[model samples]
Each structure stands twice: as C-alpha cells, then as structure tokens.
Target: MLTYQSSQDISITPTKGQDKPWLLLLLCCFWLIPGLVGHDPWKPDENVSMAIISYFMRHSDWTVASIAGVPQFSQAPLYFWVATLFVNALSWFGVAAHDAARLSTGFWMAVGLWGVGLAGRELFGRRNGRLSVVILLGCLGLPLWGHHISPAVVLLAGFAWYVYALALALKQPLRAGVLLACVFIVLLTGASWADALFAVLFAIFLFVFPQWRKFSYLITLITAILIAIPIAALWGYSLKANSSELFQTWWRYYAWGPFGGARSFAVGTSVGFLPTLLIWFAWPALPLAAWSVYLFRKELWQPHWQLLISALFFKSLFIMLATQQSEALVLPLLVPLVLLASGGVDELRRGAAAALNWFSLVTLGLAALVIWLIWIGLVTGMPLTLVDYFARFSPADVHWKGWGFVFALLVTLVWGRVLFRKQPLGRRALTNWTSGLTLVIGLLVGLFQTWIDVGKSYRPVAESLSAFMDGKHAQCIDVSTIAKDPTAALVYFTDLALDARPDNECLFVIRQTASKESATPEVLWSGHRLGDQKEIFSLYRR
Candidate 1:
C-alpha cells in the first residue's frame, strides 16, 4: 500500500529556491500573451457596457441615465463607475474612445493575472505559482473573454483573490481582519448577488470546519458585514435610479424561460468533453484535480479546502442556474480548478518516483499538443472544410499562411526544449522558461492579427463617422439598422450623446435607401461599401 507523510514531515523549503529573474520573465510573458491577442469588440454586450461607462463619466450622475436614455438596473453599477473613471482620465490625455476601452481591458486583465499568481503562490509553493501563471496565460478563453468590457470576468477574478485572502485571514488574526474588511467592501460595492451568495456559503464552510472555529474567524466575519453595509447602500441607490428595466429583464430572463430551460440537467449536463476541452485546453487537469481531492480529502475537510470548494461550488451553481448561460460564465470557475490542479502538482512532486515523473511528462506533452492546436487554429486559420462553412459570413478570408506556420514551429521548438531537456532543471526554471516563451510568442501573434490586420477594417469606418459628426456639428443623430451599419461603433467611438427622442431633432439616418420620391433627410456623407452595400448617412433638420 502507498503511504503518505504529514505536511509537517515534508521540507518546507522549495527544491529550486528563489529565482527572481525567472519570475520577472514569467510575469512579462503573462502580460504579453494576452496583450498580443488584440481586442475583438464583437459582442453587443461590450457596446452596451462602454456606453454605460461613457454616460457615467460624462454626467457624474451614477443614478441617472444620460446616454442610453433608458433606466438600467440589470446589475450593479460599481464596475461601470470604475471603468468610467478610466475612460474619463484617458480622455483628458486625448486618447480616443476605442483606445481607452482597449487600455481598460488590458489593465484589468493584468490585474487579474497578478491576482492569479499571488493566490497561486500563497496556496501552493513558488513552482506551482509559476506553472499556474503559464496555464492562465495560455488559456484562449480567458483572453477572448477579457476583450469584452464585461464585469463578469473581472468580478470573478477579483472575488477569487478575495477568497484566497480570506483563507489566509482565517489563519492569522489582526492582519486577516483588515484583509477581510477590504474584501467585504469590494464585494458589497460590486453588489453582485452571485458574490454575496458565495461569501455567505464560504462563511458557513468556515463555521462547519473544525480547524477554522477560532476567534479570528468570528472577528473577520463581523468586520466583513460592517464594511459591506455602506457600499451596498450606494449600489442600491444606483439600481433604483437608473436601471429598473434592466433588473426586470434580468429577473424575467433568469426566473423563467429559455435560460431556465438551458440550466436544466437535460441541456447543461449534456455539454460533454469536447466543448470543455476547447474551452479549458488542459482537459486532463480536471481528472487530476478530482484525484487530488480524493487523495487529500482529509485536508479538504478542514477550513482551507472548505473555502476553496465552497467558492467553486457557489460560482458554478449560480452560473449554471442562470437562465442566460454562455461559455464565458465558466471562466470564473477556472480559478478553483487552477488551485486544485496545483494541489495535484504538489501530490506528484511529493511522490516523485519514476512512475509519477513519467506521468508528469505525459501530462506536459498533452498540454503542448493543445497549445500547438490553438496556435494553428488562431493564427493560421482553420481547415478547408471549416473555412468553407464559416468564411461565407466572416468579413475576411479564412486561409492559413506560411508565416503563421513558421511562428507555430518556433513556439513548438521552444516548448520542446523546455519539456524534453535531459538535464533536469528544477521546477522553477522549467516554469519560467515555459511561461516566458508562451508570453513572447503569443503577444507577437496577437499584435500582428489585431493592430495590423483586423484593426484596419474598423478604423476607416470609425474615423469617417467621427469626422462627419464633427464637421456637420450634428448633435442629434439617429441610426437605423445599427447592426449592419456600424452605428453603435460610431456612437461609442465618437462619444456622441445619444438622442433620447431622435425624431424630434436633427437626425442622421444610416443605411436608408435614397430615392428622389422619398421625403427624408438629405445625404450628408457616404463611405466605403461593405459587401454589396455602401454605408450612407442622411441629415434631416426636424
């Protein structure tokens, strides 16, 4: 039978020791990989979010809707307020709206990565922390979701860090109370019911766990409530004033309908391994995590495991329970998975006999394969069959090029060196090299795709619209058929105030057919044709 040693028996000192140079290299890579992927502002949700931020920035009235002109109470306004500050600050430096949005996304994403690394270091050792950073940087879904100015991903990242800090607080007294207070303040200001529910569950887990029934736990709990009250009140005021419709819509969506239908086991449970693999990339990690839980079930029965498990369960359950579900919702759950996977790594490291080492090698090899597949699909384009199906609707051609192939080869080679090197470098060195390579290569690919190629497509349209609005002194502009005409982009890019009653003022009608017989606004400006149609603008003085 296999025997295990207690935590006290194991040497606390890391095998590789401190590696500052490697840690810096890993951090740089973490920033670069996600930064390079470039921003794809495709979702309407993104546009809506930006508009909300713009409104708040321009009016300084969190309680009133000056831009979208509709009462908006779908969710809490704390994220919008924070994003608004960034937009307002950047505008003072003469940055354009789109650039501001991208910068904001990039900033939050970096913060999230930092939190991931810090949390990893605290829970696991330095080696596992470095490995966690690499895994997060290489995650495709994370970067993709980060591009949209959604609070969900950011909130998830922030909440995960808070939970990590909370765990530490349970162990330490005075310092823990302060950290716990901070966490409560942030969560309450965000006012996401999801966060609140998770916090309550976490408190209960601490209460039930034998190890956490200490004075510090009680102190932290009391401080958390005290810190939360004011923030919650502010959020409540904002909701009551600006977004009643949003609240109603959200409730209806989640309470009963298709969203509810999707959550049912019949649909959600059916989402098998393929979609999971595509989303997470490290598919085997899930099983490894489960195995680790079984191995360390006793440790998990204590407060630390209870905290991590409760956070994971509540986040997943809330998301799955939602009427509206998307792949993005699962991104938050990845944090706990990363922590659990680190535990698996720890188990493997502790039992580093020949068999376990071979298993680690195989796991790393599988991870490399997934990374290569992602690089090929993202940079070079998909197979001919996939291209044929998807290319028809896409704005650009779908074809693999030689440069992308070369880039992929380079990445594979670098990864191969890190993995297959005969002279066994310690875990720290391996993690640094792997993470650094991922960051540098990933950023290069992203910059080429986003800043050079894809960015060009929208720049001209945004520029022309901005110029037209400024030249004509058009304060009141109304857009029809916004989805096809890029009107929403124009509105956001120009920071133009949306007219609540466009029919009562001078209106700029986009995409309407011009006929001599028709009685409407005269043509003000027209530009580049998309597909078989040209984007036309008509100015009408009402």
Candidate 2:
C-alpha cells in the first residue's frame, strides 16, 4: 500500500540547504572521465561491447548489435547506438574509435550524477542532493564500470533519471510526463522491459494508496502507459521490419528466457559472499542506506521510502531469480541505495561522520601511495624484488609525460586542502571524503593511463601474433576453440573476421593449449607457438 501526502504536506517539502554545484561539477568531471579517454578495450565486457559497436559502425545498423556479423541478442542496442555516435563525433577530433566510445560512458556518469542530485533535492534537502552525488561517486565499483562503455552505464543513468522523475511525479501528478519519458529512456537504452513495466505499475500502485487517486494522477498514469506502448511498438515495428530474426530473438532472450540458476543467485540470496562483497562494493552508501532505513522504519509507506523499498525489493528479487547474477544486475541498486542513504546524512552521529572521513583519507592515501610506488618501480627499476615481481607481468609501454605528473600533483594538493580544511561534521565532511576519493582516483588514472591501458589491453597480444601471420591477412588464419577474450582480441586487433573451424582452407589455424607438450595438434599442419606459456596459442599452418 502507498501513503500519499498532498503537495501541501510539510513532511515531504524540500528544504533549501547549501549546495555547491561547482564543487559537485568538479568532482563529477574528475570522477567520470578518469580511465575513460585513452584506454584500450579490456577483456570480457568492454572488448565485447567495443566489438559490437565496431560492427554497427561499419554496417550502419542502429536497431541491432552484432559481433563479427553474428547477432549478439543477449544485450539491447541502445548502448552501442549511443557509442557509435560518439565514435563518429570523436573521429573529427582524431581520437581512436574505441577510445571515443568510452567517452560516452563518462558522459553517462555525469548524467547519473545530475539525476541523483535532482532526485535528492526533490525528496530531501539540497544538502542531501549534494551528498548523494558524492556518495554515488565514492561507490567502490563505480570507477571500474563508470569509465567503460557498457549497458550497465546506460542503465545507471536511466535508473537515476527514473528515480528523479518518480520524485517529481509524487509532488505534482501532472508532472508524470517526465516520469513516463524516463521509463521510455530506460527501455530505449537497453534495460529489460521488466524495469520499464515496473515503473508504470509502481506509478499506478502509487495512486491506489491514500487519496492520491485523483483524476490528474490517474490521467498521468494512463498517459504514461499510452506513451510507452507506441514508443515500444515503434521500435519493435522497425526492428521486425529491419531484421525479423532479431526482433524475435530479442523477445525470446529477454522475455521468455529462464530465470537465474542456483549458482547465479547463491551468493545473492545466501549469506556467504554477498554480505562481504557488498560491504566494499556498495561502500559508504550501504552503511548509510541501512541507517536511513532504520531511521524511517515506521514510515515505509511514504513516497520517498516506498519508492526505494519497492524498487529495491523487485530488483533484488529479479537478481535472485536471474539465470546469471551479474555485476550489471546489481547496478540498479546503486541509485536507490544512494537515495536511501541521502536521507540519513543529517541524522548520522558526529563520531560516525568523523570515522567515515578518517577512513576515506587513510584508504585513499594508501591506495595513492601504492600507485605511486608502482609507477616509480616501473620508471626507475628500483628494488630488485619489486622488479622481479613486475617481470612476471608484461612490460607496459611506459613513457614520461610531464603534464600527467603536474595534474596529479594538483589533485594531491586539492586532497590535502579537503583533509586539512576546517569543515563541519555534516555534508562537508562527506563531501571532502568523497572529493578526496575522486581526486585520488583521478590522479592515479591520469598518471597511469598508458600503463593501465597496456597492462589490460589486447593490442599487444594481437601485435605479438601478427609476426606469425607472416604478413598474411587475419582471414588467412582460422581459429579453433580459442577462448572468448583472445578471440575478440584477435578480431579487434587484426580487424578481421575469424573462422571457427576444426580444419579450414586457410593459411593457418590458431589453437589454444594447456602446456607445450599438449600444444601439438593431431592435424597435418606445421605448428608454431605464438603466445606466452601462460596462455598458449599455437598457430598451425599448411
């Protein structure tokens, strides 16, 4: 049941608290763009996403995502579509296509910050909105996901927008247009219909509670449904017309697919990994969110409380039921958790606030120190033990960039100011903590951009294997039983389509083996091993 308060209700009225928009903008700019601009696509999700976008850009299809001409129906088309636009846009400025695609992810992070701030301001005070942005940026997993081009990034933005719209709708039922638009955006941006449908159902459910069932509320809800149908239908109609196979496949995979297995939901529903993982994964927000809920335990029916609880419950349930419990599945919880946590910022005890600040300073300080140590080790080859340890990993193509160091130094100064400045134990403490966190992250990323890129990138692997190609085209080689990462690496690096064959009418066949002895194949082709002993990729040529 929903408890609806009139627009005149003082309990729900927002207070005008101190909000430093410039400070928020600076933090977001730093947090959002670090590890974004110049990194190569990494393994698993990033490379796969990049591959799909590459395909669409080359083929000019906005309605579907494909990899090496094969439709990857597991994901929706929105992310790739948006990234393609960025790819084209950045090309004018001479940025690499894949790198440009990552810029869009940074943009999404900025949008998410705005959405969080807007939502918080509507439901709580301006101070809460500002705190929410910092809390979200401080999320442990955000730095990893926020800088990459993934469906999860779009979903993050869409979730924030949806929540902001929900807050607006609660205050003025006529403002449901914004909520409806947000729902459509979520669906359009690759979220499953379950989420969009949930938004509509939740809106209607809002009206069912209390005296909120006014004509305006009903009209808003109905209008939302009306708007959603045609938009979805239009996309479906275009999709069906463009590629009937894709249209059917999208529904089959998303709508009719089986829910998550026991293994997928085991940690989520079980007590072992999730609790420990969430401690750090959700970070400061998780603690504050719990405290906020405890504070409002008796007021769960109010719009602010009800919206978060309902959304989190359904999303968590979905995750529990999902056939694969993915990190992406947990992304929806980020904003709701932040919203809930925002409610408790003012209520946090002074001692607790001080502890949080100290915790952030120590944690980020140690992390930054470690990054600096590694950079020094890479540059000077100091400490024989450190050099030996690094020797195990591939040597990153390191070069000294003066500007990078200067920027890091500047950020370090800012972090110092935030830590030493005399600020009160309310939002400023939280802001300084998160600001320091973002600064540290930005400094590390700025200084180690190339090192990070080279360490994780597949470009080196592709370059290494190119020698064995003997000046032959990528199509000249056929791949058999190669893992997904290396396979995608070859395709992206070589800019060639791979042939999946046991024996092919090609110059060479690439095979992955466990050890040197097992590397030899029974086939009649001459085998030459290419990759390191860790990941053996043998090239068999006729």
- The sequence of per-residue lDDT tens digits that candidate 2 reaches over residues 1-542 is 23222222353234454224576677777677667776788756887887777777777557776544456665557777878899998899999888888888877778788888888877775456777888898888778788776878877888888877767764576675656665665565466665566566666666655645567666766777776677666666788899887676676565422231222212235424345567778887898999889977887767678778777776666556555566776776889888888787776778988888777777778887787777777678777688777655545644456667777777877777766644456555677768767877876777777665656677766776765454455455676567766666666666654665555566666777666544345433222222235565666666
Clashing pairs in 2: 259-323, 260-321, 260-322, 260-323
Where is model 2 more than 4 Å wrong at Cα?
1-19, 255-276, 397-400, 466-477, 500-508, 515-533
Question: Which TM-score value belongs to model 2?
Answer: 0.87
Candidate 1 residue-wise lDDT, 1-542, digit = tens: 01123353244334454334464464444444443223434444665666666667667567533343444444456667667777678789887554566566666666666666666666664445555555565454565566556666556566666755665665555665666566566555553455565565666566666667777678877776676666566655555465676445434432222233113322244334334444444333454457668878877665545666767776666655554456655666777766665555444544442444454456555655665554456445566565454333334542355454455456555555555533223233334334443644453453234323343343455567667677654475665434432544555556554453344343554444433224434655555322213334434433
Model 2 scores a C-alpha lDDT of: 0.69
lDDT of 1 at 450: 37
